[model samples]
Target: MTLTAIGLAIAATFAGWVASLGPLPIGEAREVSTTIVDRHGKLLRAYAMADGRWRLPVHAATEVDPTYLKLLFAYEDHRFRSHAGVDPLALGRAAVQLATRGHIVSGGSTITMQLARLMEPRRQRSIHAKLRQMVRAIEIEHDMTKDQILDLYLTLAPYGGNLEGIRAASIAYFGKEPKRLTLSEAALLVALPQSPENRRLDRYPNAARAARDRVLDRMVEDGVVSDADAAAAKAVSVPKLRKPMPILAPHSSDAAMSSVKNKPVVALTLDAPLQQSLETLAHDRAIALGPNISVAILAVDNASGEVLARVGSPDYFDDRRAGQVDMTRAVRSPGSTLKPFIYGMAFEDGFVHPESLIDDRPIRFGSYAPENFDMTFQGTVPVRKALQMSLNVPAVALLDRVGASRLSSRLKQAGADLVLPKDETPGLAMGLGGVGITLQDLVQLYSGLARLGNVRPLREIESRRGEEREPERLLDQVAAWQVGNVLLGTPPPENGVHNRIAFKTGTSYGYRDAWSIGFDGRMTIGVWVGRPDGAPVPGIAGRTAAAPILFDAFARTGKLPSTLPKPPRGTLIASNAKLPLPLRRYRPLGELVRTDGERAPHIQFPIDGSRIDASGGDGMSAAMPVKVAGGVLPITMLVNGVSVGELDNRRQRLVDSPGPGFARLTVIDAKGAADTVVIRIQ
Candidate 1:
């Protein structure tokens, strides 16, 4: 110790001793709560006050783990129950050791003194230090309950590194809850009060491990844990070292820190594990896509519109290649991902429905006429099908039907960031996502669908220093589900899986940029892989490559509930967009013939000769029944080529069905022929 620092310590000690009878000082400094907690309130990170504040209820003393509390007592002050804040014996021993050996005073201060020091101002030690420490210690003993003091200590102690308190510190190191921690882990955390930075688990894993083990051994010797338990804990894998994205993990992010800095923290909807999972996935993707092109992966919890993880770049510290661009928050062109927002507005405007049809053939909007990726045409189709294939012409066509001016206004209303040239770029083609947007915006926009159309901005930081806002609805829940239907399904252009996912994909002009944005009930993820300079990265296409990543990232982020945040009023149909209730009636040709016997004679065969039936199991069809030979014999059929029918042993009656030759016909002849016979028996 320096002479001045030593002198200051001695003077402070005497001052503390003299001041013990009066008001003891309490450090009111707001130490960071470094507790790492899971969505379920389990601790994940172990250690510190730096960037810590997670949920710590005012009455959270009950949830405080006994083992962790005991550890604070054992390490900070072994005789906490009897001490009057300052442990004279330990202090005297510390004094001897320091004067002789030089270095840390070891475990001499009582928990009260440590708490006093924590809440007090930092200063070089002096003779007055002992008096100051003693006084503050007495004040703490007088003012707080053992549990309250314990809670205060746990909430204030500094674990090595930026971790300040137990809450933040818990997840910071061990990747589990403090209450759930093994004796060894709790002891390791206790050891951290001396120096978190000097004992970073990641930077100095060996030292941390040794210190951690020794703490465990101490606990075992003190009867805190059985030798067998200590041995078992040691045998367990060294719980994860550092938080997943410490550089950006909820533990390290400015946003996460600000959320809990001022008050008892609450559990945030953000998932560190999910975020870490996405970051790893994104880094690998950035590497695979090659150098010069950086990729950002963003995952949003659909139910709450909370963004779980955002991998800003390939590697945050890697300056040359993956500079600090948080693609999730940074504004960028979302390409087609922005299309759904327009759809949401249109849905609100009552211009379309899931089954509403539109023309996909190109039509000029001023100087710009949006072309399909293949430059092909699919004359006319429903809005639902257009969205299914992400057909450009149909989307622009629907936008025109909704009117661009209203569309723009609605986008602003829905919280889309509209930063574009006054008149350039988006002609009628803007609906096809010619308009630019960022991944964050896309996630938020999809959050409308994800959260039932209540599109709130994806906030990186919490609203209040200590409070959280109740989630608001942005889009109609029904419409959001409808939109969800559009984003996910069989990976299109043909068939993949009816694998239920709802998302939108976009490939920009010249194929330079490709984006896929959407969400299921559980998560919303947006992937943008392209050149930052506006030039194209070769071979990047939305469905072909980008969508897969979106798919992978979304699937990997964990499944969540599909509750839709309430949608803004009027955006959804109160009853599912007036969809047909699908009231289907089947006439055996016999029923129809019985009702309209006069017309029954117009049939090529008698209605009585045929047994009636219908297909399209969901009652999506009106019916048509046919009769062939006498005794309701077998019928020849060729439906699109494949034939199917029966009247032999399998069936013996004139078959009454919606179709005898439609390719999807349910039945044919004994040869299983798709009926070529297109006659109506009725």
Candidate 2:
């Protein structure tokens, strides 16, 4: 052999030795590539929070219609398969251009080489880097087969930081999964990896299209496609991208995966539009409440057990992991939120009915004597009246009969953490929402109860690749319906704005927490408004305050079920005039029972203090100031109806005695709905 031949043999041997380790980006590890879709499998958001995680959804290679995949292949890597790793032909041409014409004009690597470089780290690109990449490629070829390598390359290529693969890249660029990729969109994604930072496909479409056509022409010449097919692909129009994915609750829902902690991707049961709208409404409400008031909101899809949205605090992206001490995961006192569940369960278990008789009178639960909102109660009341007024004694009595342990078990089955004491956790107090649970847990549980006892797990995100996991049934379908009927705010005939909602409110022991959870045919929402320390926000009850938040949330979401659960066929109950009615002050709109319909109630009482105005008035704003302004002043300033600091009724502050509760204002609507809390003279 000639000396040059001997040298070539040695070089070849060295090259073969160096081709082992693949080149993946090393310094900054790529962020997880993730895509979030909605219940309908539409992309809602692509989480490419940092620069390292880009996803390219896997559009089935066969599904890549004529012009699409081929066009993309032509634009991205014409000599993709013809070369081993580097395209020697392209290299030779570039070399010729450089030697004869001067400056370096084109890249010398082939698509496979690019894939190898991406799969390994950027640092591995030296001659040794190339050689190692080749070795790994050869090994990969032997193990994975060509199709596997292509799939890996598609999923692992980085578009930028955080976007580690093509699936993510597809979502990031076009806001949809790859299988649904259109020709123009596929063309765009394929053209991105070359200069992911500069030759932006999303922004510079014309340039991307030009590059795509070139790829098609190359594919035609390489025999991967025919001239006519290439022409057809080239002629196909670009696909219009659906709306861009939202950048909502950015990494918050990512935590939903931590609970299971095993999968690469988690598909949450969430309604995208509902989630987005819920968050937006909560955010806007927060904005209206002033930047100082940090608010968190949670909602769910009524039919499907999907957690639509969870905004732990006002800011969606702030310290996603740290933002929540637990991020809507921790359970706290459910306050009145538990009422609806118990009521639903009660209605299901047949302990009470809308017309059942009960004493709303103050009753003692063991030694714990709970007080009604007014610390006074109507003597004998109907089941609905006891619930509406949130009368303590009656609720506890109901819990006593159901047995707290049974209710707790029911809660667990419904997906809330309600641990009962060996003595049954004193749920008479829990009937008032004494049991602690999370806002999400409350919503999820209540949604199930509202769903006629069917609890479907909710999530903050959607999955891109897997089959939609069917929900675990939580409640008896008939039982859930019964519960829903009792909680339904509106009856037939005259459904109000919040006509379809079925809700209940709760206040924890000693004003510690306030919660209102309820749902309708289409959606169920839960709201808890209070301090994190569990301090009582004086005078607030499930019906009065927390319930309003739920009402507001449902009204804002717009996509509620139009039809409601009808009473069982021929399931008629003759009305008894002796039965007492359930009435509360200023009940939130969503919780109002629409009794004006075909089989609706007659003489629907006005929410307490509902203006009997022969002369009409606007009644009162939910934010109207209710204060104690009598000769006897309160000892402190009332915040949300609670006396915090000494009352200051100007110099007119009358030296007062603490008689009964602090003097305060109460607001009730024209209907029987009402809301009242205690306040000091301030």
Cα RMSD of all models vs. native, in order, equals 15.7, 18.5
Task: Give the lowest summed-lDDT range of ten residues in model 1.
Answer: 582-591
lDDT of 2: 0.54
Q: What lDDT, from 0 to 1, does candidate 1 have?
A: 0.59
Q: How well does candidate 2 score on lDDT at residue 291?
A: 31
Candidate 1 runs further than 4 Å off? 1-25, 28-30, 33-79, 86-109, 113-135, 151-245, 248-252, 256-267, 301-303, 321-323, 340-359, 380-383, 422-426, 450-496, 560-682
369-422 per-residue lDDT for model 1 (tens digits)? 787777898876766667777778767765664457655655666777756656
**Estimated TM-score for each candidate:** 0.61, 0.60
lDDT of 1 at 201: 71
- Candidate 1, position 176, lDDT: 43
